[model samples]
Target: MADIEFPSVEWFQALADITKEDPTYRKFGRLNAVIVFKCGDKHISTNFDVLNIHEIREVGENARRDADFVIEMEPDVWRGMLDDIKKNGHASLDWTLNTLDLRFDEPIHRNELQDGFKADMFFRYNPSLQAFFDNAAKIPTKFVAPVA
Candidate 1:
């Protein structure tokens, strides 16, 4: 299979496919949340429903407001995390989303509606979210070039 470009629908879909087969993911139990990824100018959303990833697609800028929470990060940070995942079969403790949230000054876990309860979903279901992205290690992924 060709290397899927990161931050694209195809790339995310590939990850979702792998996540579906992972029994550990199911063990983490069900989660219903619309999580948005803010990578540079891209707005990618994934709806996690009933223990499976229901949908993953690019969305309009304003569409992020509809998600339960948004993880806003620079494109480079995402690349770094993926690279680590590929090398180690998963993100190292430091590169995990939970760790990143604490390391960065900008809140990666956020609620567009300013609902604290919704924002906490990122943590509540963190193990599942970590497992979802960890599957990226199983895929051949190519990072997109940075904008000049």
Candidate 2:
């Protein structure tokens, strides 16, 4: 199979498909959080409702406001993380979202509504989230640099 473009609908859907088949995701418990991925011009929103990851879609204009918490980063950063997962079959400790959040400046700057609880959900659900991304190792990915 050809490598899916990073940040494309096909790419996110591929990961979502993996989450559906993997039972490990079930062990994480129920989750109800809207996760936003901001890679340059692209704004992708994924709803982790109840037991499964539902509705992985793209949005226009407002991603952060629409989502519970938005993870904004350059496309290169996303590519690196995904590539690491593909190589290692999971993210190395350094590439995990929590570690990346700490390493980057203004990683998750909240706008207007300051919900610490929502932000904390990322950590609370880290294992499942990590496993979700970890499944990316099964899929081949193509890197596309974000538009400057």
Candidate 3:
């Protein structure tokens, strides 16, 4: 298996690729939203069109202004959650996106950029989004070294 770096477009693409081929990812129905994931200063955005992830790219900090919403957290927190997913084949109860969003420790902040209408997509497609991330377990990933 090839090792892909986390928080990179390549890594996110791997996830999208895997999910595209899985019938399970299709059951949630079509999703139409632009979700930006932020780790510290890095911003990666993915556009979900119909039933597939159409694009994944690294965007500038200004991406949030265009996204329906942004999910922000420290890289360490992301790594921790990824590690947990890898170990369990999927996120455990505590590491699930909803669970992490609820926890005080390194909580995943959902910053709504638009009105409640657009921001509601995150919840409307929560199962699909969670399944998208769960596909990460299918890829072997390497964490980029943290800068001092």
Best by TM-score: 1
Determine the C-alpha RMSD for candidate 3 after optimal superposition of all C-alphas. 2.0
Candidate 1 regions exceeding 4 Å error are 146-148
lDDT of 2 by residue, 1-148 (tens): 7988887778888989888778988787788888887788887888988777778888875666777777777777787888898889999988998888788766543332678777777777878888888999988887777674
lDDT of 1 by residue, 1-148 (tens): 9988877899888989889889988899989999998887888899998877867999988898899999987888898888899899999988999999999877788998899999999999999999999999999988786452
Worst 10 contiguous positions by lDDT, candidate 1: 139-148
Q: What tens-digit string does per-residue lDDT give for candidate 3 at 1-148?
A: 8899887889888899999887888987898888899876778899988987867999987768888878886788799889988999888898888887778664464545547677666678888988888888889999985442
Q: RMSD of candidate 2 to the true fold?
A: 1.7
For all candidates in order, the CA lDDT equals 0.88, 0.80, 0.82
Per-candidate TM vs. native? 0.95, 0.90, 0.91
User: Given candidate 2, what's the lDDT at residue 113?
Assistant: 62
Whose lDDT is higher: candidate 1's or candidate 2's? 1
- TM-score, cand. 1 vs. native: 0.95
Candidate ordering by lDDT (highest first): 1, 3, 2
Better of 2 and 3 by TM-score: 3
